[model samples]
Target: MRTPAARTRAGSAALAATAALLLGLAAAPAAVAGADHRQDATTLDGLAHRSGRYFGSAVDNPELADTDYANLLGSEFGQTTPGNGMKWYATEPRRGVFDFTAGDEIVNYARSKGLTVRGHTLLWHSQLPDWLSSGTWSADELRSILKNHITQVVKHYRGKVFAWDVANEIMNEDGTYRDNIFYKTIGPSYIADALRWARAADPKAKLYLNDYNVEGTGAKSDAYYALIQRLKADGVPVDGFGMQAHLALQYGFPYQMRQNIQRFADLGVDVAVTELDIRMILPADATRTAQQADWYGQVTSACLAVRRCVGITLWGYSDRHSWIPAAFEGQGAALPWDEELRRKPAYDAIGAALTAAAVRRTG
Candidate 1:
């Protein structure tokens, strides 16, 4: 295996060049736009049109200048989300100071392009501003703040966003509640409260409990199952489960994961493979790359096998733009697209899975 530093340096060089090329062409005259681009012009668009679903990507504000990716994505997926922009930190950096301009720009852009919009999250532990996490606030105060934020944000986007990640990453690996400030202060009931408030703010939009590592059975998944059962029994407003299918080449594909997904659907909720990517160490040889492809195929097959799995969004369009490389040392080329914006084996694998035996409907 290549060292993480070596891989980062190599991957960084490749990604930098790719980013530069994309940025440069974005500034070029519109007439020449279609002449030199490398992305498969028809691939994503064709898949989305045929599948009746949407693909998504995260965007940095700077990348917004290069509308090529967005244009390409919109053509195919016809749906967009902040990816990270709508998170608690970006939306509300200060206690009461809400800033939706950045996120709103992305949402408005998607809408203008005739695309459906999904809000990335309403509640999450990551990317939360320091003040919210560190401030000395009473339990009641925290609950009040949380309720207000959810109500305000959901109401603001009412009728526009097709779905919202109402409560994100709330459960632990053992499926027990992750102890966050919200959970600590407001207790386990905060999840239900957030969902109820979101529904009250926008009754029409679908609300989801989003998390990573819940795609397969284990401690974390078991916890989610119990939580969902309790919430359903209590008549909480959770309508969907956002499975962040962040996979790795080495880990065995969670084969029985569909059974868990079916259980959720049985409770009358939808399941979406949200923010998916399969990461592998850099200098990927042919065999390692093929393993990555197989991992993607297995995940997509699971989603297709489970009936309630309605949406599958690659974490990003290409490895060049993937966050995993930076976030996870040595983990590069995590997505279906290669450095030059070309489709990899993983792309073909997913496409095949989607077209696989008619998806088995559950619940």
Candidate 2:
């Protein structure tokens, strides 16, 4: 718990090499499930609730159009994150003009389904409107623009989203800060300012800084640990650290993920497996699928082991609509459900993990 900033920063030279090995870590299969074989009384959310945690999934607008897809989503999980609706490009496509049409639709749907929403992001280097990214502006102008965007979006969704990613994927795989447009235009202080503006707009909404590959102890994660420590010392409004946990079985599960969560929890903030998904090389086999199941249980167990780990969210719940196959060519079949909406071994693994955590709470 002592400042990891100094201890970690000293090893900056070797950080980049570890990060380049694998940008992320993560795998899945099929069959029909009947009432008799399933645990009739336990839902993933129900078990998580007993342990004071939540089981959630990320949802995009297109998936909601399919009833079966929507049904499983609303029924199985207690929380949802808009996969793209709340991004700057989607919400404010033009400078000085804004549209909340898409974001609002997702928010209203979550409300109807009794699911709480998580605002995907207020600041990110990708998916930004062409206008903002292309324009060449002075330091003062860009700074104002950033604060305005964060303020406007957070205010629009005020009480609806319980947590806002605030900033997403702001660090590179290496332990160094990413040279995003924000960093180039306004320097590193932009992160602190962005979080503060978000807090001002929606004080009740928990503010988080989210990134991938930080679920384990490594040079990349060490960089974040140091950064969060410095941000806290400066009185930044960072409320949580979100580990995307986008795992790939080929790279193996993250090293000591539980201890990683605990270290950040000691920083005095909540932690979450914000975008959990496990993938493997193409042409899936039985052994690889089983390993994927074990990783899922480990992730759930890691979260349950920490006092401040509040929730777990899959990037998507089914391989049918996954972003993986496209994102990682040859790597697909990443969720607990298969293309036919059938539960896979991963489903049972997660359920067992949550049930065990609930039992531990009572024991």
Candidate 3:
């Protein structure tokens, strides 16, 4: 019934309405894309920040000399652990004489990069100075020495470091205590005493007992759980547990890693992946690399699933300076970044896992 001009006008109006409707639908997704774009732009630390956690890496003093390595580390991670600078040998080289030069270098570097530090250790079986390791002392003498060492170190780095691995690698794989120099001389009570002294030195610093081979629910981890529970019952200032998570491809992925992290979280203390690295035999293949990526994602997911699994710190971010090549003969390529500072698949896997966690939290 309409004239030709009227028909054309109605057709134009309908087209305009359809286009506007289409634009409305497109704008809805565009808003979501904006969020996704923001997420993509965020750094690993930023993604972790969304979930109230941190992502960290370990850096040794010598490695910081590598400009590229240092720059990337300072930019990417939110936290750092001094690989060796904070150890007993580096911190206190002589009897009753302390030198914090090495640890200070790392702490200062971390500050420049806006990264908080986790004091690598106050005590460890290995890397002890000759004065402490080679000497023979009665229980009382050693106790005095231990208390002084812990108090001094913790006091020195108290405000700078958020946490301290008060004692490292104290238990054997069989769930029994390792007969290290401390155990042999100061007796088992040294563990509790060391924690107590560290607490007195810095009541605010989180205290943790760290060990490898405890990523899974095995005898080693069981020993730590029981020890931490007893320590808590007795009102020790035990604040967290650190699982070194030094995984090897040949050994297979840790058994029930998520469940293991959750169990430690239920104990009313934070859990952390203190030193994470996955190594394989020399000459990595596609299959191994893929599997390694899978393992990295799994570990990240496991940590993210638990509220108390505080953060993850790679032993070293890049294979360029990884300790595996020197320590583990015939096994290397253990880190997320390759020797050339190129990202390996593991890096992407970790990013994806962190991104997923952030998305879940925002959603």
Candidate 4:
């Protein structure tokens, strides 16, 4: 597998091809274009705010520096998550060594755009610096390390971030905690400890335990439910649950998404659709595109139904800079916008959902 740097360079080339594809699709006629833009309607954040929610997208550092992308981000989204800049590896390359350059850059950009920021994560098993990943440490030693890291990073972002993915991908698919280093070394309480340390560092930022495949009813989500219930009972500072809705058409939509969200809300915490994207086996056709669009509306509808579902955030907003193609071979076209910054069917579908939701409130 290519390193992230290599993939990023390759992604630029993919963007060029995607842009060409967008130009070809752009010639498809005016009616399609009009529909794609949601009838030249209001921004996503505008539509979401009407229904007392936020609409947001994740952003990486390089893309935020692009003028066109930056402008679109400012106008379209109310919140942003740094795709990687705030992660443990990026922030601390060595034991006791700290770096905030990348994260600070993103935070400043989000503030400039009047976009509230969500910290991507406080702890995860992957993407750790070599010192931590390869070294051996006792249980108490690892626990101290984790608490110190979480406290510092959370303190740095403090009032700037609305929430933190305090613990991420902690559970495996079968409703059990993955055998990650944190779990093995610090035991299950690492989650509650992480949340507590983060809360102490920044009392205002909402703390969340985020994971993929938890958007629907399943064993994995059930595990999260039990864990959350336990944590709440013990008075953990967990403020929200995050469902990383990374869907693929080949696998079918999640089973009864609304109920899945509602259960978490009933547990007394806000829920968010974080890192959302719908990818299909490549060479997108009208059929696949329409399916993707419909899925977007459905996701928004599910989130709207639950009062505590505070928001929906796209993993990244455009096909141009998406991590899909690289991460999942032969699969792409997973976002609402095409490479030329043009809205696709999914954009209109999302627009329609948000508008419909707001209308229901006003009606």
List ranges where model 1 is wrong by over 4 Å.
1-42, 45-52, 357-363
For model 3, residues 1-363, the per-residue Cα lDDT tens digits are 001111111232233234324333212211211122213224566567777788889999999999888887877678899999999998889988999999999999888777889998998999999888889899899999989999999999989999999999999989999999889997899999999999999999999999998988878899999999999999888999998989988877775788988998899999999999999998999877877777787788899999999999999999999999999999999998899977766766676677667778889
Order candidates by lDDT, high to low: 4, 3, 2, 1
Name the lDDT value of residue 182 in candidate 1.
88
Per-residue alpha-carbon lDDT of candidate 2 for residues 1-363, written as tens digits (9 for 90 to 100): 111211112322222222212211111111122211122224566567888888889999999898788876777777899999999999889987989988998888778767788899999999999999999988899999998999999999998999999988888877777998998989888999999999999999999999998887888889888988999999999899999998888776775789999999999999999999999898889977777777787789899999899999999999999999999999988998899987766777777677667667899
For model 4, give the RMSD to the true fold: 8.5
Cand. 1 Cα-lDDT: 0.70
**Which is the winner by lDDT between candidate 2 and candidate 4?**
4
Model 4 — which ten-residue stretch has the worst lDDT?
1-10
Alpha-carbon TM-score of each model against the true structure: 0.84, 0.89, 0.89, 0.89
lDDT of 4 by residue, 1-363 (tens): 001111111232233234324333323222211122222225677668888898889999899767777778766788889999999999999998889999999899878767889998889999999999998999999999998999889988888999999999999889989999999887898888999999999999999999998877778999999999999999998899999999988777875789889999999999999999999998999978877877777888899989999999999999889999999999999999988888887776676677667779999
For each candidate, C-alpha RMSD in Å? 8.0, 9.1, 13.9, 8.5
C-alpha lDDT of candidate 4 relative to the true structure? 0.83
| Residue 265, candidate 1: C-alpha displacement in angstroms | 1.1
lDDT of 1 by residue, 1-363 (tens): 111111111232233234334433222222222222123223432343344444555555555676666565554454556777788888889988898887888777766656567788998887889989888878899998898889888888888898998988888775578898888888888889998999999999998988887777778877777788889899998899888888776565666667877888887899888888888878788877766766676676666666677767777777666788778887788887777666676666555544432222211
